[model samples]
Target chain A: MSTNKIDPTKWVDKYSDYLFNYTIVRVNDREIANDLISETFLAGLKSMKNFKGEASERTWLISILKRKIIDHYRRINSKKGQAEVRIKYSDDSNEGDWLEEQAPDRLDMTAEDIMENEELGLAIIRCMENLPEKQAKIFKMKTIEGFDTEAICNEFNITPSNLWVIIHRARTTLAQCLEKNWF
Target chain B: MSKFKSIFVDCSKAGNCCDKAQYNEASLPEKVKMLVHLALCKPCRKYSNKNTKLTKLIKDCDLKTCTEEEKQAWKEKIKQEIALKDRG
Candidate 1:
């Protein structure tokens, strides 16, 4: 677990692509994603001793990246909040996004195909963005990433009932978003 | 029947496709306790069905894996950096 020894042999084989994609997905910016991925690796290596294999290697790395993303947004919102009043997600007038009808056409697309289709992926991502931070993250990790409820509860430090409420609310919110925006 | 009775009657134990586990996973008897409510609660029934649909949609949209080159690059970059950080 020691990051001290630059075992290029062991390192490069393990986590390059997954890290990159993770950063790309979260940051939605390639260069920033690249930097964040690097930062995640470095942090992981330094704290390698802390890697108890508790959540697997990849989750740990993304956890770091997630922090970075939050930091990025905090800075953005702070500045943007004052300069350009942010639109409240709750305001009901379609927020000028021109949401499409619910797409009842849930046919002919494979899971992999849906994931690859930027339009479909972005559609789901947009719905997620409308959720509260905690609910959105939990839903993404548990439902989208196939993480178990126990893992979600442990990671978020939420009660079982609370977890269910958050997840249920997230599902309901997402359902509404899809129906309103993409169908 | 009565409204409160209807509320109880309509309720279901979660996880039964009919009851839909995501809504609640209480036992059959527990669900029966809410049977009247379930029978009347359109929202819960729709919710259960929506949960089922969402679950399927999520499962069907699992992300695709990255290419080998992307994998190689990430590994190289992350490991080198880890080596540097550990040294500090």
Candidate 2:
């Protein structure tokens, strides 16, 4: 095992941008992403002795950062049981069907329209940020990471029903938000 | 027709079906229900279409990253904290 004590000061110059980008995309918040990068570096420093040189230092730091993000989501979920309550109350009206006025209009954007429109991307990210923290994390994991239902259920310790409900609510809220902001 | 009964689903159920279909978690019956509902209900159809588009947009969007100045400042702050801890 090649044991080179990784320099803490060098990490910022080397991996900060990469880590920052990785985290900002996942969290969709700059301040939180910066905090996560700091935490990841500290955590990596504490565990530096465990580094076996099996992976590059950058990869090692990234692994720590990913776990930090997951922990961040778990912490958000545990702090409030309101997510379930929100889901329950949201669909109670009209048995979850959209009202005539609330129903989304056709987006009418061609693939070219969508790809060329930078505003649309920003609108989506903004809407995602508006999502309840746990919902945003779950939506990112499901859609961006392509995590399967069982994996998400195992990670969140939620039932399949709960997962579906959270995702359903997240999508509904995103759709409504996008309709208001983008359309 | 028997085929119609197999596919028939209500609007409320169709909402759940749409979500399930997005995740590839829908049962055969649920998939059939969503298809039937989408074929018949314009609003639900629109909702499904938009939902798919939103997911695609989010998945594909080139999200902004933190700037170099921001990263450098965070790094310096973290280094300061580590030094303080070492001294104390």
Candidate 3:
């Protein structure tokens, strides 16, 4: 286990882009992503003595950045109540179901088609940004990272019901947003 | 109770069913209720189908990354901060 300190000077030029790209995708906020990068470097510097060269510098930095992202979400989740207000349906008769008039037209595109449509991709990101911060983070963890329900509940210190409610709210908002913007 | 009573659900319940199905968290009764609702309500069915597709789209979409200029600026900022800390 080599104990040489990672030179702080070379970090910016070598790994900044990789780390920035990684964080921007997960957080979808450039300012926040940049902040995480700064935090990662500072944390890394403090723990440089513990670096054993087991993972490449990039991997180590990414691991730190990942923790920072999780911490960011955890901090946000702790402050907010678990039971978010339910979204109101257009019509009271149907309880909380979407009104027929507001129901989105069926999307006909395939996964391949969506992948190629840069406009649609941007639209999706915009919709995600519109979601409440905690919902957006939870949605990303579940869908993008494919974290299981138990893992997510454990991480957020939320119950299964709370997790499901958040997921439902997030999906409904995303579907409605995409339908309005993309379809 | 009749099987009809057990299986029947309103549109709102159907919406919950759709969301639960996305996560594979719906119970057997909820699943049955959703299926019945979808069969009868075209709009709810469309909602369920689209909701599922949206999850798939996000899972599949290749997200955009930071630009080179942005990356460079971030790196510069980090370097400046670390240098200041060292000076202090």
Interface RMSD of each: 7.6, 7.6, 7.8
Distance (Å) between predicted and true CA of A52, model 1? 45
**Could you give the C-alpha RMSD of every candidate to the true structure, in order shown?**
16.4, 20.3, 20.5
Off by over 4 Å in 3: A1-119, B27-29, B62-88
lDDT: worst 10-residue window of model 2 chain A = A82-91
DockQ, per model, reads: 0.20, 0.19, 0.16
**Candidate 3 local distance difference test against the native:** 0.75
Backbone collision tally, model 2 = 0
TM-score of predicted chain B, candidate 2 = 0.60
Q: Candidate 2 overall Cα lDDT vs. reference?
A: 0.75
The TM-score measured for candidate 3 stands at 0.49
Instruction: Please give the ranking of all candidate structures by DockQ, highest first, separated by commas.
Output: 1, 2, 3
B1-88 per-residue lDDT for model 3 (tens digits): 7976878888877887788787777888889888988999999988888888886766555554445576577667767777777798
Q: Kindly list the per-residue Cα lDDT of model 3 for residues A100-131, writing each as its tens digit.
A: 65777647866567446545555666567668
Q: Pick the candidate with the highest TM-score.
A: 3
Write down the TM-score of every candidate.
Answer: 0.42, 0.48, 0.49
Candidate 2 displacement at residue A138 in angstroms = 1.1
Give a tens-digit lDDT track for model 2, residues B16-61: 8888777677788788778878999999988888878776766555
Docking band of candidate 3: incorrect
